[model samples]
Target: MNIQKMKELIDKLSQASRAYYDEDKPIMSDKQYDALYDELAALENSTGIIMAGSPTQKVQGSVSEAFEKVRHSEPMLSAQKTKDVNEVVSFAGGREVNVSWKLDGLTLVLIYDGGTLQKALTRGNGEFGEDVTANARMISNIPLTIPYKERVELRGECLISWKAFDEVNTDGEYSAARNLAAGSIRQLDPMVTKSRKLSFIPFKLISPARTTKSEDLKWLASLGFDVVENINAASNLKEVIKQFAPEKYDYPVDGVIIEYNDNQYARSLGTTGHHPNSIIALKWADETYETQLTGIELNPTRTGMVSLKAVFKGVDAGGAILTKATLHNVDYMKNLQLGVGDTITVYRANMVIPAIDDNLTRSDTYELPKTCPCCGEPLEIRLAETAHFLWCTNKECPAKQVRKFSYFVSRPAMNILGLSDKILEKFLSLGLIKDFSDIYELSMHKDQIVSLDGFGEKSYLKLIDAIEKSKDVEFSHFITSMAIPNVGTSSAKTIAAHFSTYEDFRNAAVNDDFDFTELTDFGGTVADNIYNWFADKKNVEEFDKVKSHVNIIYPEKKQTNANFEGKTVVVTGKLVNFTRDGITKELENMGAKVSGSVSKKTSFLIVGADAGSKLKKAEELGIPVISEEAFKNMI
Candidate 1:
């Protein structure tokens, strides 16, 4: 309660906040920080002594004057957090409570007037924020216009989905999704924001707070806002923890937020300089599994980058069996001093992906592979952004070709079902399939294919049928399946939109007349990649052969349909009423743009049984997911 102690607490908390928010690193756990904050607040209250720089007295944020600053109507204080489940139960106090994921992203405030979005700002220093209205408008899920005409202010988290982070991070520049989201929203150019696919999930209504917290979230959803997902009347802390299993959620959630359902009672308790007493954050303790590293596997990707994977003793982590973890690149390997026969500790990052937490024995004996596994070509180290990776310098390495072919038949590319990588490898070994065009000619080897191990008559017939069905592909699908460097599904869609027909695109690429950099995210590198890919005589000839057997359906001219115009949609799992292509065509017909992955811009996720990562990602982003029957009804 003394002024000296208050100053100490203030300095410590401020340092932690700066590291967590600005540096994307944490010096203290959420629990440790919250406990210290609470002690500081209690001391100030009891002794009637508050330091000028106390964390509780003001919002904890650094002001970046790069953008215009806007003062917040009300201070956006941090939430009190705890590691103990007992504290959460005590905080709930037998009252109905809503427990939701504490999304690890940058905080944003949105202002609306006359049912139209007016302004958007970052939670800079709590009292004021940097104006990012232009960038906010570009986010797909942040509704430009809501049903309510009255002036309203909302608080939310601006985040990049894990799926989006991986796609946009083609060069592996960013370390985490939160960091990517932070940097993306702060970009001065709104075009950058659009390219990154940042999304906003509103968690609190700052103005006209007339309804209970639970009711408010429902009303927000009704008004076309993507409200944060939560479970109402969660019985206990254990129940909330069960629901918030890290592996089940697609986005990065550091903890869980538990708040009283009754908004009035929560407000009555008041708040300190740091956090409100009404709500608390429960941070899950990371569970680590110790295992011995047996060996390392170098896996070549489509881009010729060889990723080092740690092969260790199998560990059951959070119900999933994990025996291998990604070493990322050479830099990570050197940092860990990884070696065979070394003891290592592994844990699921966010309870999902297996990650090596620590190497207890820094044996430092693991040697980097000198040659590519598939083609025995000499490997070279390349520096990309901040990381160093092992790459196959040989452009014609069979390993790279195999990965490229595998990607070509992936769901996001050609949607060629039943052609597993093992099957592709077999076909390649037998010289039955040489290039993209050879996939279509697979039917010619039906007798040979059926005679192969694991290839029965029924499976062979099914593979042929799938390949034949894939022949009727769209321009975007065909372009994406080509495995052009730096060109993904989104970029392919953009290219397809600009050049309606395959012939037009090919001609433009050949002549280098079109300005591809003018597209949303396309740059000189992408343009160069496109031109170079087409300029190769072999590629051109192979593409011509592939183009002969398939029908390329050019994109339809933009049609203004009220139902789903300007909407971005993702279809995942299985559908009863529509095939993947059929639903995609239907969505396109209704003016919806179909995306291969789920992102913040995704308006709706059409999900069915056994929905995978996309469905979980949709739930995390609070994007509306419609069932097959519901989709039929809407159409």
Candidate 2:
């Protein structure tokens, strides 16, 4: 442990960080990176010689400042971190570590002048950030008014809702939730930001300077602000991260953060220029290995495209051995130069799914199957605008039918409770269901379902009741359940609202006049997909079957006063008196349009307790704003 060695180790770690953040590629494995970082620390400790520009001292300047720089009242210190549990134990000298979810989101500093939110800034370059006060107000989770209107500043992560992300991103191209959240926060237009369904969950009270650690989470929760809960208190980092790493997650997370909870202890520990000595981020060590591909299996999709499924020699993924990884399509296989008997580096990308990172051997070559795996029909290679895909000409593939049925029972579609994959498969095998529409006819076989292994008379009757209830669905759900290509819930709603009736929609499809331009969210790609879906005779037949069995419930009309006729109402956040949809429906019923975003023409921006960004925009636009309670009374 010498000065020279320390300098070399620091240089290596710094280079690694730069490579990861700048290039989106890691030069060293997580374990190797940590070992280097630890060696640097050990050298510094033994020699008492801290390098002038050590990686341990200063936070790497990565994100460029997008606004004016402001020196924090208390310098926003970066957390001290260790991915290894035993290393954290060594670092802490066996002290307790409080572990929590390191939410992948935009960090915001909220300043309260007197009792009002004065300004909110993003963690841009750790010094400066764009003033996003107007946009921040529209987020549903942040409280507009707090118990302590007394000057206090808070630090938290602003995130996107799981459901909201799916709704806004009609195109399923967003790779990570954090990326989508960052894009939403950086949107130039307030309306665009408002529509994204961003929410804030405060983790720290940065200012109004408390002497103690504050245990502020409970207090914030009481004030109706969303707070991230600490899951485990462990003596080591390993136990803590294991506690946090559940089987599945809706949002993507990179690491777990562990910090000293005692305020005085944290203060006494002090901080380096980069991260606090009291806090540290622990990243999971992804296990990777070279595996040989056994063969490529093509699974035909409902879109008539055969997706390449790669069967690799069993590789451990998140503690489980997995043998198959989806190649996505024929182009994916070709792009990666994948072949049977070729060794490929397989690892869980973000600890979610097994992905072939790179091919290690190309001594032997394999070709895409000429025949469809399911139907044994000759495969046709189509040169799509983006890439080549193996097309399965057979439209009635069982795999495709199963997928359609799965979507129909999914939450976004008909939401038929208790109709899972097992039941659907059973019904399909029994010849009770062969298509998505066949679900509507399930009630006819209630007696037969009761006799099935897992089901008794009571369970079968309950499932039948749920299916029968799902028959009378909202217009949006009904349209979504149709399994129209690219017609997701949001797009479906737009189409439903535009057409007003199922008959009108069908007629428009028949006449080739289903113009989607007028709809708020519909794009050319979605419109074209819709047209293609309806044009198929088989799809039309399936639609007819479901249409005959189910009842579509349009927006119920209320007695209109025309008092707020043509006036735009922007509703923000969870209403205590009503749900978001309920408020929108009531407003629309009253001859006012319930818009997704705040605009200059918006007459009223109805806000709830934690109304975040919309209220900020209303203030900026000099538009009048009302609370949910006030809105209820007013209406």
Candidate 3:
């Protein structure tokens, strides 16, 4: 063995791992990656030398700087993977094993205390992880509180379904469910995660040692978790795989995980440097088929970066026939040596995202378009810190403005009713909406809008009414309408409550020496975003223009609860009279800090139906518990 190829494989795999985990981007197919990995394993065995920082030795992924990193109580290790069903059967060796979908999304370790969800962490390199507690709370399927008390730790995949992916990714922004799910769950703002409709499906119980993995799943499900679907592999790997196959799942699953059913036996088997000995992943490589590339499609994004997509002859992947696959960047396209009419292999990563595996023809004949397809403007090559991407520098590109217009009409923003992305696109194409301010002037094109498909006189009138109604939006809504990065409804409301008016908010960002980071939960990056957005001439002009059209109504804070001022309150359980957001806003308005968990600092705990652990904790801590009606009376 040269060992030179071994070193080279390590480097290549390391790079690919970084791209996939740190960047949330995959540069190669699962099959190709696995083959390289297996080859690396063979080389390592032959040479008896595992290089430092080798992908084989350690669990991959970088801890996000946006989150607080914490060491796990027990290391969340990786698993030994194989594509062969016989290998899985051999691993089983007649002993019962639990087979489940190896979900292709971000893994989270959720910690519960006193029957209430307390914390959640991402599997960052297994030994340590990022704190994603707030974001985890937003997952739709995960219960806030469960029946079983005592401290417990559960491991699960935080995912967005293909259906939810379709709903959220209106502009083809994300190519796959895993990509969107990971991105959404790792968001700094939980509201963003909430909007995406992520679900946490528990695959393993990390705490309170049970009889078997199957027992753990049953217990977790009883505790209100959407447990991962599983079946008993009782000396029958083939039958087990059939139930846990790629085509059988709704969410993304790259493979099936088989773990020993006997907990004590599995524990005795012990773990390797990177994975456990008792568990293995039968990697179901995405269905690959040969196809011919037809052409490349380019889409310009709000950030000015252009996305390159390869259109190929339709081929069946996992069951669905997909023709288009994202090239990611020009570097990827060039690496594949992809050209028009070139014979290429296509497969869907995670059984949903169509991706090119390799170029069979090796034509290397494709040329970068001289101009952006959308704007017909010369494309600029942006030199990023690590990579280069094509940019459409044209500021007035319709593709760029579509995002802004969509944001402007969103419910939390302008509250403009009946305006969808498709309708906005139609408006952009017809030149009815050029800028944010033009949304207010939509009444001018009423006759034209009425004539468009799916538009009747009643619908046009309703739209016009909405546009007129939006002019009377509150200051918070107006601020949210700007679509500044990381500035969602809550942050915007904070800014609005401080500034009191659109003019004051605008001036603070540009004209005055104002520190947005001084606000509650507002970080330095958010402050910088406000400053940088204001610095832009186009942003300033558009903001002011839109501001002129809208009546900036600052909500009057009717503070009836004088004693509640500066108090720390925690609201728990389901309330019929008010939603969580409603109660939180009300508390905040009365100068109280609304904490998520019950603590010694908590001055009051508002109890609702199924108050659960928080109420119990409050009682134990001697914290005051009040009924919803009692809190309402205080309000």
Candidate 4:
């Protein structure tokens, strides 16, 4: 076993785990993670080198500081996972095993004292967890008082039903129910969790144990806990699993958990640090469907970077027809050796996002475009620290301009309402819009605008009114409209505070007098971006042109230290009185840095109605959560 290769695999796997479990941003698919883990395990077996922090040795988990930490009565080990049904059959070894849905949600330990629900904790690093009693009390199905609850530790999956997920995620913000459920359960405020409509389904009874696994579940069910669906795995495991397909159930399930029915016999099998020998998780292989690759679509972004997407004949998998999947980066495409017209297999990753499982054809004949698909500018491959991406050599590619213009008029920037992407593209193609200034001059083409499809006298008037109204913009928002690299809402607010007007900030960058690096979170890379953006002759001209048409209002920043001074605040949900961007800018003016997501580092979270995952994360982290009304009073 190569030690260097092992180290690299370990690091990559660890990072991916953290990305999914901690950050809620998954970088790789389940197949990719399984492959890496299998390789590491094989290496460890051959070399006898179980390196420190190897995921194979320890159950993967991270303890968030948002809740009160509690030590588990006994370590909650992970189940050894397998896709093969034969392995599960072998593990049973003729003894009757109880097979149940391996619910795809956060594993939670619910504690009850005096026949009343007292505490709830997540499986944080197996032995330690944060107390989430308040939220657990609000679970729709969880009984506040159970008959058998005499200081009992009940283990179960906290789940959000597919129906609930679909209803709550009307905006399609969350990709899976399991994630949304986990987020909902970990909330600091029980009310936030209650509204998400989560449920607890018990799988095991830790203290005051029953004779059999089936008996424990039955008892829990009788006590009003929604125990996981189960069946007797009497050597017909495959047939049983087939009957209980994931789609039939409203709750999300990744696989089935099979274990011995007799509690004493199962306990005698012992355990590794990572998993118990008694229980095994039978994961269903991602159901992939074959399709013919038709072509490759090169999607160019506003920054002139191009991304690859496989355009294939649509195939139905898990009820959704899939036509395309991301090729990820140049390295991934190269490994697949994908070519146009090649045979490919695609599947829904986690039964949600479409992903390419494999490429059967090894033609390696795919010809990456040498010119930008939009502008025909000579393309170049740029290698970043992580991956290589194809880039349009010309900065003034029409695709880039269209995307840039679309962004400039977006809510975070100028907050223009009527200019949709299609409208902007049409306007650009017709020479109605040339630059940021041209957006304001759209009124000049009134006769032409009203004549187009999807446009009329009322709509044209609305568009013009929106464009005119966008002129009285916040200075920070106006700065964001410029689309300055590295200068987003937060940085724009910082820069806005440094100077009174757009001209002072513009001239400071143009003349190289003020140091942007001195500002909060403005590193050398950010400062360099400001200088480079101003250095562009075209950008300078566009800035002056747009400046002449709009009124940039620099809000009065609080000079004295405020309650939120140097604090990190996150706003979520639909506010009663303020827009998302409005509240964020308001917080910035009050001397706080506004973040889009919540983490342990966040000082507080300001929420309104229908707050989503960020609000849940804030609760889990034990961060100070304030309502919009409460926030108003504080201000």
TM-score for each prediction? 0.69, 0.53, 0.71, 0.56
Candidate 2: where is the Cα deviation over 4 Å? 1-77, 94-97, 160-172, 190-199, 209-214, 231-242, 248-251, 293-311, 314-342, 349-552, 557-635
For model 4, which pairs clash? 66-621, 66-622, 188-619
Candidate 4 residues 250-269, lDDT tens each?
78887888888999998898
lDDT top scorer: 3
Best by TM-score: 3
Over 143-219, each residue of candidate 3 has an lDDT whose tens digit, in order, gives: 78877789999899998777667656655656567778888888876656766768788899988968999999877
Candidates in order have lDDT scores of 0.80, 0.68, 0.81, 0.79
> Candidate 3 regions off by >4 Å?
42-54, 62-69, 112-119, 131-151, 167-175, 183-197, 222-224, 235-237, 245-250, 316-319, 383-387, 406-432, 437-481, 487-635
**What does candidate 1 score on TM?**
0.69
**lDDT (tens digit, per residue) of candidate 1 on 79-150:** 876778888888888888888888878999999999999999999888888899988987877888877899
Superposition-based RMSD of candidate 1 using all C-alpha atoms, in angstroms: 7.4
Better of 1 and 3 by TM-score: 3
Give the C-alpha miss distance for residue 461 in model 4, angstroms: 3.1
The true-versus-predicted C-alpha distance at residue 295 of model 1, in Å, is 2.5
